[model samples]
Target chain A: MTGGARRADPKPMDVDALIDDPGTKIVVCCGAGGVGKTTTAAALALRAAERGRRTVVITVDPARRLAQSMGLEELDNTPRPVPLPRPVTAGGGSRDGQAARVSGDGQDGQDGQGSLHAMMLDMKRTFDEVVREHADPERARQILANPFYQTLSTSFSGTQEYMAMEKLGQLRQSGEWDLIVVDTPPSRSALDFLDAPKRLGRFLDGRLIRFLGPAGSGTFRLLGAGMNMVGSVVGKIVGTRFLNDLRSFVAAFDTVFGGFQERAERTYRLLRAPGTAFVVVAVPDSDAMREASFFVKRLAEDAMPLAGLVVNRTHPLPTGPGADLSAEWASTAADTLADTHPLAVAALRSHAERVRRRERELWLLERMTSTHPDTRVTEVAARPEDVHDLVGLREIGSALAGDER
Target chain B: MTGKGGTGKTTAATALALALATGGGRVLLMEVEGRQGVASLLGSAPLPYEERVMLSAPGGGSVSVLAADAEAALLEYLEMFYGMRRAGQALTKLGAVDFATTIAPGLRDVLLTGKATEAVRRREGGRRSPGGPHQYDAVVMDAPPTGRIGRFLNVNSEVAGLARMGPIHEHAERAMSVIRSDQARVHFVTLLEEMPAQETRDGIAEVEALGLRPGAVLVNMVGPRLLEGVELTAAAIGELDEVALIDGLRVVGATDPTGLAADLAGEVRSYALRHLLELRVRGELEDVGRPLVELPRLEGGMDRAALTGLARRLSEQGVRK
Candidate 1:
């Protein structure tokens, strides 16, 4: 089916089938802000674990709701086990007919067969940890202790993306869980997350380290004295101590540059690896779709595997013709209640406008998929009830499974 | 134009236009996205391009508004720059023009900046006409947000590495002249929120790197003073009364007056302290070395009264120039 027609034989949420596939490991959920990406990540993980696969979900949202949804008081970078229902399998058995419990240790274990773990990243803390992990303790401590480094670690300029990837790499290498699901921070441009690793990596490799490298030993230092003389003059005019402090910080981190560079390269490769899949999540809005399209094109350029697209909070148009209650209601509201209840009339009009906009968005998305055949599209109906607990998540999972709205 | 969204760049542009108009200098406010944010904020409909549509404020100032849609602007830009309609059609069909004009990262900035520059230059007597070419004394642009603002304003430098010698390169150089000149200024609008503040700081750094001086930093939606004097002192003390304190101590053998009052006071004190800390953080913004102004949050949404009040506050803050 094509051109806005509903798909025949809609695919239900097959957590077991997805977990069993060796090719699938990473599940990335992305969307505009306030679209429930954190809850979606929790639900997907819960569903995977319910199917008897050990799963871990990570969220980069600064909001505490991720921890709150999982019934936890707080969350840090480290993974914590989520208390699953005691009897393991829900509804008695696995629905996909796969083994309820695998017998291995690394891949899966006997009694710990079905488990769930979750982590919420403190981006700045994670960045600091990475520095401490890779660099000399003293050097890392010095950098961490620096006020500028502390600010830059948390400050904007494509740093959050780098930190997100760093956490992803840590989780991927941990071998602690069967499935890893990551929720990215709401970005101004969705593609920034994908481009972040490269942008930051290049900055570290090309400009930052060179400018900050040792003054007397490295190649930069040999040329540094002359540059410094000129820089001093310019720096005075600019009234900033950037060059001086930058040089010191770079010199301090120079010993660890090789390690940092290698790790960044590894992380970049892992993102492009076949085991990783990018699920571009977006709402059905003109601006959101525009950003999503840009993200898809960027992903293609990077050669990262596109798993599918999840269009979240999609307004379900009344499937049949009768849903056109809008036009008739609008006319009646206009005649009898225009001045008496303008707000009510206005709200009705807004709702109709929104429905029309959704139709257009669905059409555009259908057109996008036609050019790229492998890309699958899934729609999640807008939930009036907030998803804040396991029960709410189950409803969301059922929605994803294509249960009737 | 910056890449950062939701910043008050549009609002500042509109207010600045009003300010200049109030000072008896004709001004034009131009928007690139066709968003109607400026018009709506000013309580008017979307203004068409190249037309001097007047906007009247409660204070008796008149400002003209213009909305430059990308397609129409591109066609017009080509007509003016190349003096050929054929080039526009051929470029559009080839998709180079669209990509060059739209999908291009910095092109939007260039076009918006180019339009503002045209408005600025047109103020001087036209080559073919007598007297002052246009009535406007200044042109204000509600640029893109802070994230990409640097790249937008510095598109010429970004592309300079590629287009070294061409009409496009020449056009970029001309645009840069107006952008970097003293007559033109790019102001930034932000709230006191962590992310917006951080973005603003980085934006200042980046814009300076691109050799353009940022005009001012307008802190929009500034919180009103909610606590003061005796009530504030009482709240800070956790509602501890001297009579209750002594009575409770005598009856319940309560040794620590700090117990309930201390806990309550601690929470209130922390909340107040956090606001003070935010103010200190706002203070560090002074390091950017630009004029900083704060606009109090409107109790309601944007309307004529709020805009007038904001314009008055802006004048008091000395952003009227």
Candidate 2:
């Protein structure tokens, strides 16, 4: 089959060794939708914490499964501590160690080597929080109060990405954890999170600046008259006070553009810094691989530090001489039943063919990864059950650590 | 509403348009994404916003294409709503208009839907005017993927919350009338796979919650032929004696001499049978209430020829019926 013959026996994974490696700051888990990215992120963080490194996992996925995995029914915009089993004391008695908590609320906790924290981002809430944190409280409140800002924060194309960075920055600057593991949204918008800060910064620094920045008195009067005339015409046509509201919102938020621009730049710089790393996640399917490749190229183009790739739900072929038994049995059955029972033979043949095809696909994936010498290629076996709790995550983490040769 | 990209939304929409148009109805194929994927699939150049390009199909049917360039469409929208001809000029001057229209999420969606509504209302022929084509018999939209489709189609709700009681609100109400009507429909295209199927379910629930009609579900890349009957059972095969089976095989035996030949042939046949069964199980696509149609997997990707073949297959699958 693919990857040469499989190992004689399945190897045990070294979760502790991988988690303790100081260079591994980012753990990106990407795959097609519903492939357990959220579970992977939580497990990675759990593994890190178990190794005595303070860890925080953040997810921007709208699904509540991430929170539920941490035993919380729901999460908010801020980071909360998740309750983990306290380490055993040297005396063989359990000490009342720090509580592990996971929160959706967008606040950072203090740095600790033995603790774990988790959070889910509320995109719009995080964006508003960023604005409120950077601008004068009154100005921020005014902007938040504006209907346009409300819509823009929630529905804007790059806003989720920008907000994700803002949330990451908060965690990074907090120094609350030794390592941060982020579970990005599914492949659909994950890349946007990487590109969002720069795009948003450009938007703020360019057109937004021109539209909302201070204008010369003479220019203001001329523009105001022009705006008024246009508004009157549009009012007649579409019959709305849209122009008037837009004007007021622009005028109110104009003064804060400089602050917004600065924060966006800071967030962008944080993402590009060496302290952070980008992990690309994908499944073995063609669609997922295409997105992963695009993301890898985009990361290179943007000069982002790509750590490696984490291919999830990879099918593990059975190993050794016994691996071909199913095929041999099918062929023998096929010949015996060729005339007496064509359908049974056909069914067996089909099953064997599917397994062989999957092997070929796996081989192609390995070939695709050959060009990236530096990027580590890791695969997680497809689990028989969905991962939903600490035990499941631990199993996933063990599989991810690779076979202990 | 399928989460998978390149599933065949454009092809289905195009086929539906052709079906309507050939049945003696005028059709408008609107594309929200600026990719011009639909036009390209139809072997025509990209169309501009507010302009119509006639597409004569090989089957003696015709369709029209309209591309909603977000920036230009937004400018047209501003002009139509606010008598702001200079607004477009102003946006161009600041170089913000293009970015605003294209990069702004939901803005493009609003403009595209607004334009569709406008097309629905634009009269084909006045009572006294003869010989003019009807305004439009059907509008087929190759919408965004399922992830944001709900928000994309329901732009009116967001806009209405902002622009209450004005002409904008009035227009939004009018657009809602068309969207909420049975005449307007949304179909999802997905592969009969796990993830895409799950997303389709979620997308349908979300779309229905937003008060939009979820029409047919098109399952693409269905498996080919399947082998059926008693031959599928193990007992029938076990009944054969080894010697008898070998002699029977020898009687019809073909020449074969190669290294690893037996294993390789078995592998190839095994693979073929697996796909057949996969295709068969995929045919049970009853997860959604909409009629399920199957599109066979083409050997090549969705190029022009592939798309035409897909359209023809879709017609043969009785999409109109």
lDDT of 2 at B299: 31
TM-scores of chain A across candidates: 0.80, 0.78
Candidate 2: deviation at residue B207, Å? 2.9
**Residue-level lDDT tens digits of model 2 in B96-201:** 5644564555445666777887776566665456566557766778787887788878877866656665655666677778778877777888875554565677
Candidate 1 local lDDT, A1-405, one digit each (tens):
112344432333344455556567788777544446677777777877776667788877533444665645564676666655334544423312123332222444345566666777788888888788778778998888765465457643457777888888887887766678888776645666776666566655654346434555554465656455433432331124434554566666666666555667788888888778777776664445555666777788889876666677665544332134343343444345445433233333433333444556566566656555456667787553345556677677666655563
The reply for model 1, stretches above 4 Å from the true place, is A1-16, A19-22, A84-112, A221-230, A237-240, A319-357, A370-374, B1-321
User: What's model 2's TM-score?
Assistant: 0.74
Give per-residue CA lDDT, model 1, range B172-274, as digits (tens): 7788898898876767777665556767788888887777887788887675443455644554445624443333323323234334223323333433443
The TM-score values for the models, in the order shown, are 0.55, 0.74
Model no. 1, DockQ: 0.03
Q: What is candidate 1's CA lDDT for residue B145?
A: 65
Q: What fraction of the reference structure's interface contacts does model 2 contain?
A: 0.21
